[model samples]
Target: MRTLDHAACARAIFESIGGGENLVSAAHCATRLRLVVADAPKVDQKRLESLPGVMGVFCAGGQLQIILGTGTVNRVYEEFIKLSGLPGAPAAQKCTAPVLPLPQRLVKTLGDVFVPILPAIVAAGLLTGILDALGRALPAVAAADWFSFLKMVSGTAFVSLPVLVALSSARVFGGNLFLGGVVGLCMVHPTLLNAWSVGTAENVPVWHLLCFNVKQVGYQGHVIPVIIAVWLMSRLERWFRSRVPAALDLFVTPLCTVLITTFVTFTILGPCFSFAENCMIGLARQLSTVGHGIGALVMGALYPVTVVCGLHHMYNVIEAGLLSAGSLNIWMPIASAANFAQCGACLAVAFKTRDPKNKTVAIPSALSAALGITEPAIFGVNLRYVRPFVCAMVGGAVGAWFGTVTGIGATAYGVTGLPGFLIVGGYILPYAELLALSGGVAFAATWLFWQDVPAQDKTPG
Candidate 1:
């Protein structure tokens, strides 16, 4: 990236994508340069990828996104606006990405909301893993006062997820942050019976609203309900602020927002969306159990596709739910397979390529993949030779099949490929087996099927 001029990269993108005439809007989200273009078909994807500092390019949900990695996207985005000089598109309010269809938007929104909260979740997960490992070695360590404190530390995220979601989702939907926390707290109030306990108890307390018997349940580990609740709350808060006189706004806004949000969440949103959340969770769990190895194979194969579409982070929600429910995140091993397979595919390309320039790119890309970042390998090397990319997916599926049969999982959400060993949760033997097999299969497949690389591709810039 040091060799890549930010302005040059921006110009390359703008010129390749039909310049300001084509860009409907532009925005940056962490890594990707998210843009809404007039016509996706007009974009020259190869020229864009061929440019320095560019990682990958894909059109998904009607957005032409350039994956430029973190720390660099901001510079590129800034240069883009400065060069293009597009008008009336304020960075904050202007549509950055496409207005996706409702279902995709909903999933994307939920994933976006959870991403900010993942650091806490990951820390909690790792803490639990550490405690579990330590407890086995020293039984008395588990009973210590410090250990009790540590248990509370790790449990806080799962126990109070609503507040976390509320805090993040409120910001996402343009609501007052503190008020969102208030709404979240109302759902998980100390007086209320926990949401998890609702299923076990008979004849639980309820508040009737319309046709729905809204149970007085604490939303301890729920995600969707809190998000929907906060979104509604944000809208209500803004509406009140708009109608109320300026002098009374300070008092009137928070009061109406809290009252309406609390009543609506527990009564309507919580009870209703909880069912949907449960159904989603049940589906995920069902996938694991349906045909055992079949689930792992499917998840593994499709995992890379999600990465390609820039939607892989969505799995964090599902993984968090699985960890919160019990001991393991069964889906982690499937991801492990996908990641290691990419590494092997890239390495095979490095070994097979006759060109010095191709080898220069392929070797480092493979090493980067081994370290848990696959963008360089996927976009820079394996993807150039389409056969290797396809081989990697097949290898991922094969490896995950082994993982499901042996039942391995990871403790943390992010962390895979070779670094996956650090977070491997349930069993070591099976996890190692999965990695070994996934890499081996992908490497073999690439070597066997990807025997020919175009001469022109060998002289890559």
Candidate 2:
């Protein structure tokens, strides 16, 4: 084959596949370009994979991924979007389906909306874990003297969670990013917090009885309500933008949207959140009652798959529930160990693989996994190397089983990566020997299972 013109090839591939015009949504994880197409029939996957810069093509998780080398993927994705059209250019069409039962649809929709934000949540969890570790090592850091700075690092996402959701939700809603963020801010702002706080106060005046106690305190990084609020806000914003007179549109539209959204958030969204939290707690308790060994086994076996489909955020809710209830539960520790187990497995694959391309991906995958970001490892190495992935799962299951048997629990809910060990300090101090033993077993299993694969078997030939 002749040498390929990288940019030209990317453009041709995207154009051939119906360009960004056919996209309902687009996102990327470690190794794949994920796109939701308006018409899957219009796409020519064979041609796309055959393009000069393209490596492969596949559809997974409802996304048609056109695999490109790491460096050029983002560039190609940006150019493709530009060529297709910006959001609301009339080229993009919404998918239609028969109405689903309310509960089932809500559950599925929540999964989709929260997937993209998982990275940020993982980052926040990692930061919290590291800070917790540092505080334990040097108690002075946790004291009031250094409190503000530490809190800023740890609480940034939690406090400004609405903003993060707004950014992600903008892409999902096909609405203005800034406007969406503003709506999110309103949900989590001091005013709402103050109102809720006052209503719940012990000695509040009788006049306040007219105001409902929203009971929800922080909306930062909250999933269900903010997503619902943003979706509504986006629809309302789009409608008003189209119908309102241009002359008075700016002031009138925002004013009305804000007022309506604020009311909805306080009255409907906040209560919904409270109910969801209660449900999640109930579910967690139920899972815990089923014996930790069974719970851990399930988590270990399915954690990687959960991550692959971007459903891992669902687990974060469980962790958050544990935190809200004042102690860590069964999930986070297993999740953390499973992530590390994948890293160890990937590292073993890196050593076993002679393919330079696979080697390039494996090294970074290992590093990121250790740092608490395992997508690179999971996608780049483990998933690709079937044996390694299975090995990691087995390792995770073993680790989780050990932890559960020994009553291992996290003190906080966050990412389960290496840095997360800090969150285990006081909670598992007496059980350090057990924790170490479990980790050792996981590592050993990963190494044993991944070590002997031949170099020729590394890449998909």
Q: Look at candidate 1 and tell me the lDDT of residue 154.
A: 83
Q: Can you give the lDDT of residue 237 in candidate 2? A: 82
Give the runs in model 1 whose Cα sits over 4 Å from its true position.
1-26, 29-31, 35-47, 70-93, 96-99, 197-213, 355-361, 457-461
Model 2 alpha-carbon drift over 4 Å, by segment: 1-27, 35-57, 66-131, 140-144, 160-171, 175-186, 189-200, 203-222, 285-289, 319-330, 348-368, 373-387, 403-416, 421-461
lDDT of candidate 1 over 1-461, digit per residue (tens): 24668988899999999988988878766567878888888899878876777766766666777867667788998899898776423442246434566656666676778878878977887787777777877889999999999989988888888899899999889899999998889889988888677778886787776776777778886777888999999999989988999999999999988998888787767778888887887887777656968987888887788877657866776776676665578788888888889989989988988866566667767776776677767766777668898889998999988988887777766667776665664476788888889989999999998875566644322
Local lDDT at 331 for model 2: 72
Q: Which ten residues in a row have the lowest lDDT in candidate 2?
A: 89-98
Give lDDT: candidate 2, residue 37.
82
